[model samples]
Target: MACMPDSMRARYDVVIVGAGHNGLTAAAYAARGGRSVLVLERADHVGGAAVSARPFAGVDARLSRYSYLVSLMPRQVVEELRLPITLKRRRYSSYTPVADGGLLVDTQDDAATRASFRRLTGSEADFEAWGRFYAMTAEVARRLAPTLTEPLLPRSAVRDLVIGAVGEVAWRSLFEEPLGEVLRRTFADDVVRGVAATDGLIGTFADVDEPSLRQNRCFLYHVIGNGTGDWDVPVGGMGAVSGALHDAAVAAGASIVTSATVTSVDPGASGVEVAWTDAAGRTRGVTAGHLLAGCAPAELERLLGGDDAARPGGEAPASYPEGAQLKVNMLLTRLPRLRDDVDPVAAFSGTLHVNESLTQLQDAHAQAAAGRIPDLPPSEIYCHTLSDRTILGPSFARTEAQTITLFGLHMPTRLFRADPDGSRERALRATLASLNSVLAEPIEDVLALDAHGAPCLEVRTPVDLEGDVGLPGGHIFHRDLSWPFAESDDAAGRWGVETEHPRVLLAGAGARRGGGVSGIPGRAAAMVVLGSAAG
Candidate 1:
């Protein structure tokens, strides 16, 4: 209900809900095609969950709070939208801690990687397995990634494509079994297995051996991004991506009104009626030819007419799809000194993994599933300031300041549901302590304090994510990210964003092949609207 007052157009060709990155993309595409477009956002700004903002009081740093790093955004969208964003790849992929020196996956040098693994694991078995596994995955990614932008491929067809690329052994081991089982079977060392398995549990919290293979879905998206699976750093933080999309939207003649939270959407044969509340609590309404639910699919259904809001296709939504990750953003005065002898800059530049050996990750999941927060939460940390100093001000550059984003895996939303406030405090304590367990000194030692003398750290629990970002249960993908292939006959031939309603469509992460800040669903949704006009 909180919003700034702005006069909305009485009629438009398209009315897109939720002015997040996806919404903006849809608006730009729709308007560029000569359709009168209106974008309605609930928040005070654009970039719903993918925004970069200053969290701490009196801090000059702009941190990527919710969604950090870029891996899945396609070059096609960037070129088409004329997005002015630069993504940089880390020379080192990941570093895992062990007894003496940690295991570092240096992307630039295979000899360095081999030396690190051989020194840490005492053999080249897992490293060899790691190479073979990625090669197979790379082939699968090459065959599958191109299919995402087209009409949904049948699951069997996609399976055949994977089999054609990687053969029966990989398909049975990777697609059939749980990702944890595959990692366990492939690698000789526990640390190496954990490193590979971490990809499967990024935004998901489940046993690697869980029968559902939800972990497999997560793993596929993590690696298949651009087919190479390399997570890259945005040169000027995540805000650059959002800002560029916003510019493209504006240039395409889309009217974006912020602080305008959409309250209702009614679809009809003729046109759709959209209603909302302004900043002063005044009610307002508008109508558009086509309605795009640029928010979560479930949120769209809720806005469709209150009690009459039927589930799309009458399929009941999941009872409680909870996101299982904790995002912690901190402005560190200096990088923490690691137990390993590598320079702090080199150590923090890549994924600085903590307490995520294969058995240890499984133990954390067991503890969390049993309703107790894991004593030592599994997490991965990286320093954005190391790659892009633009996020920090001149003062920061002079002081060599750094921004560290630590994402703790396996912390589900259910754990914090009962005691929301207390759980955050306890979870933050546990996660920080878990992090300190791996560091030479407490991480708090080098943190820049706020004016109030509190450490410049902002902890966003699943509860906070659900509350602030309008993500139901703080589920980052809006719901479980579906396999890119089609699940139903109705959705097989059309754009993935199509809805049961003739004029309503999904343009957010809830759509199939929707996750991260990729904007694939937005592009798909816009194609649906524009395609109808051309037809």
Candidate 2:
């Protein structure tokens, strides 16, 4: 049975800071293992970036809007928690509107997608090879999922020996060929190749042509399970997934304190002391034997007095990846116009890549690397209204397309040699202009717009999360998935759920095998704590 809180008690066996999915997962596992646990969230509600809110009077909007699609979450975590998810699965699709008024749509149906690819490249062999490659890549991704969800340590001595032997064989299998070499050998058409490379570079700073092609396979990991090769949004909105996770944590005997901003973490000889201010400006302190930090590494560093040297030697202070992001979420009154060849539903299902080819994408990435936004920037747009008909359907008393989510990547956080406000407005205008060209009509007259850059996002959320999103130089998988940092040393190979700190653990995206909506880090962290206690 769960224990009811006693008056003014500020101590527990474990205290998790940050109510993001990972943090909650850590708390849930800790409590289930017979440890008294408490979770603190800076936001009024849980689900850090993976939250849903009604920005407009009647329309629901997502915060940190573009990070909604989920494919990277591990299946084990879902099964362990028995999360109630009403997945609204849809096929993946993408459109590239050419400058010559031509639009190309890539659909999920293998035949249709291949047909589209052949139209761009004139090679049926290329089509067949692309399918073969996707199959193989997906197989590797499936094999990797189990490794991602659990702690990277062997469970038992015998199990460790078995894994070590098996790992030797597996490592030898992949050593025969580099991932980029494998892709090149599989696909003959650049268009097909470019399509495969798109997701690989989505949230990463790495160039598509880089030799780290195995990392691309990890990007595909997010889209595999839902019977679609693309990421899917939940019914209602992204918030539903977070809501389900939050519900699971609360039901598992965990308490979430919201609107509670933690100011400092004083790690004493016996336990860690957490100081924070409540919603009413009252000061408070909580101590726990084990402390799980859900905030980003950098933010946690700040809370811990910016003691970079205090971290285990060789662990660098977390920093933002090379590229910064500007997210724009709008509530539209009507659906944007689509070309005759384009499907309206395609807008909402998969990410729509606009304004660049592979070469252009490379150029844009280079420009951002140099701290400049490209003149012809690459933009990714998603029309959620088309996917979830309920969002605006009831508001208009009919099935209507009203809300759109747009995330413009590689936008120069610094404008081209101009004043701050002027530069921001110019960048915003450029973004709107690029979007307007592909959109059916102008978006300036839309209901409302909420926009934020890295700094602004850091202010709203934890600075470390922003850093994590921009990890290992903004490559989403933190590092090349195939070349995960080895865990032989405590100074290296430390991420989600487990860290060098004796009782301190990471339950956020910064942990090894980091990032994503899947609460694997939290679950893994809890297991680690439990296992230690049991021993």
Candidate 3:
């Protein structure tokens, strides 16, 4: 039997702050475990960063605004929750343009893909290398997928596991070495190398030679998602994923409160007291057996009041992440014309890579590292309405309406912090101009205007994200992604969500193997609570 949300009884077994997918997921698991759960969200709607909305006024299209695509989410979470989610396969994988006819990676046609590679690189060896590299990643995924859900494996044990699964050669090449050097070593052409390395630079603001090898971590997460690394489009936009999770948690009898801003948390040996301001601006406090931080670690620290209470010698304070991606969602009157003979439908159907050649990518990174947005912003784009037409309103569909979401790489938060508006405008101009260099027509020519008579470009710089969605430094992953393996003895063989504080756990992107739309962190956090109860 589920206890109703009673003001008289102001305590719950679990109080999860932030109703993002991860928090909702944790709430669902806790509720299913027969523990009273309460989820507090600052926004009126749930689904934190992963959400869909009509950003432009008077626009009928629903765009997957902040976090788009479905890659890292595991099927186990969906099955366990019985979520009604649908994912559509992109017919094309990716298309990168070059001086030649350009490279098209088709999901179904191997002959076409090989030919495209041959056309772009003019080498049969490069085509074979591409196949071998993907095969290696596929094998790595097969071996590592199960480990993500389990307790953290020791670093040495994880190394051995990788060696056994793929090979010692791959372990040294992909895991130990930097991704940039690995790509150069694997591919013959610079364009091919650049395309392959784009995964390594999704949100990370590092080059291949950086000592931390954070790019490698970023690459591993990008490729190993779902054990196949295939990024599928969710029907009904990203909000559907959240909607399903919200439904599951609610159905499981968890109490969810919206527009509730958590003010502070006082953790004790027996329980935790959480204070928050409600939508009505009234202060409310509740006690819970455990408190989960679905926001960033820094936010969690603030809620705890300070870092003074942190375990003296625990893992170094969580790194402040600087995101290097700019998201632009637009309603297109029609797909932009392509430079190559390829149809815009085919190009936009999947990931459309623009100005992302090897030398270009490296140059962009160098420029951005030097404290300037790249002159030619490397980017990739995809049209959501092509796969899921339901996001388009009936009347708007008559206008041949579509939604294009562009993700520009290497635009770190630092670039936007000094002058938010000016930086965003400059980035948008540079990004679109860079995009225009490859297109037969300017994308601006194909955009539909909002009611306010402005082009329907809803730009989301890191600054906008930080203010609106509460991602510190606008980092999509909450913090730098931790290695899947335990880095120290204290963290060994434990659920990766555990923190220095015994009763507090990370239910968001700060946890190990935490990135993308995957609810792995959320599920792992709940398991820790459940395990403690069992013990």
lDDT of 3 by residue, 1-535 (tens): 1223678878888999999989989989988998889888888889998888988888888889987789888888888999999998898988887656788888799898888887887778898999999999988887777888888888888789889878898888767888877888899888788888888888777787677889889888888877888898999999999999988898988999888889899989888999999889999999988998888876788788876322212222445567788999899888887779987788888888889987888899999989999999999998898888988888777767899999999999889877889999999999999999998899899989998999999788877877788887778887777777899987888988887888889899888878789999899999999888631
> What TM-score, computed on C-alpha atoms, does each candidate reach?
0.95, 0.79, 0.96
Model 2 residue pairs with clashes = 71-222, 72-222, 296-464, 337-440, 495-511, 495-512, 496-511, 496-512, 497-506
The positional error of residue 271 in candidate 3, measured at the CA in angstroms, is 0.6
Clashing pairs in 3: none
Best-to-worst ranking by lDDT: 3, 1, 2
Give the per-residue lDDT of model 2 (tens digit) for 1-535: 1223443887878888888777877877777678877787766777776766655443334433435567666556777778777555455656655543322444446667666666666657876776555555455445545556543542233234333544443332233344344445666754445555556555555565455554343454443442234466666666777777777777777777887778888776678888887779888888878888776665576677875432221234444332244456666555566543566566545666666555666677787777675666666766665666554435342635355566655653233223544555556666777777766766665444334311111111111223333222232333333332333544232334555557777767666655566676677678777876531
Could you tell which candidate, 2 or 3, scores higher by TM-score? Answer: 3
| Candidates' C-alpha lDDT | 0.84, 0.58, 0.85
Q: Is candidate 2 or candidate 3 better by lDDT?
A: 3
| Candidate 1 residue-wise lDDT, 1-535, digit = tens | 1222235548888988987778888977887888878888877888898888989887888998898888777778888888889998888888887767799888888998998889988988877888898999888888877887788987788878888887988778767798877887888888888988998898888899989998898889998887777889988788888888888888888888777878888888788998987656778898888998889877887887543323222323446557898989999888887888877777788999999999989999999999989999999998888888998878777896799999999899888878878998999999999999878889999999987899999988877887788787678988887788887766677778888898899999998889898888998899889988631
Model 1 residue pairs with clashes? 3-279
Provide the lDDT at 112 for model 3: 86
Model 1's TM-score against the true structure: 0.95
Candidate 3, residue 535: CA error in Å?
12
RMSD of each: 3.1, 6.2, 3.4
Give candidate 1 misplaced runs (Cα > 4 Å): 1-8, 306-318
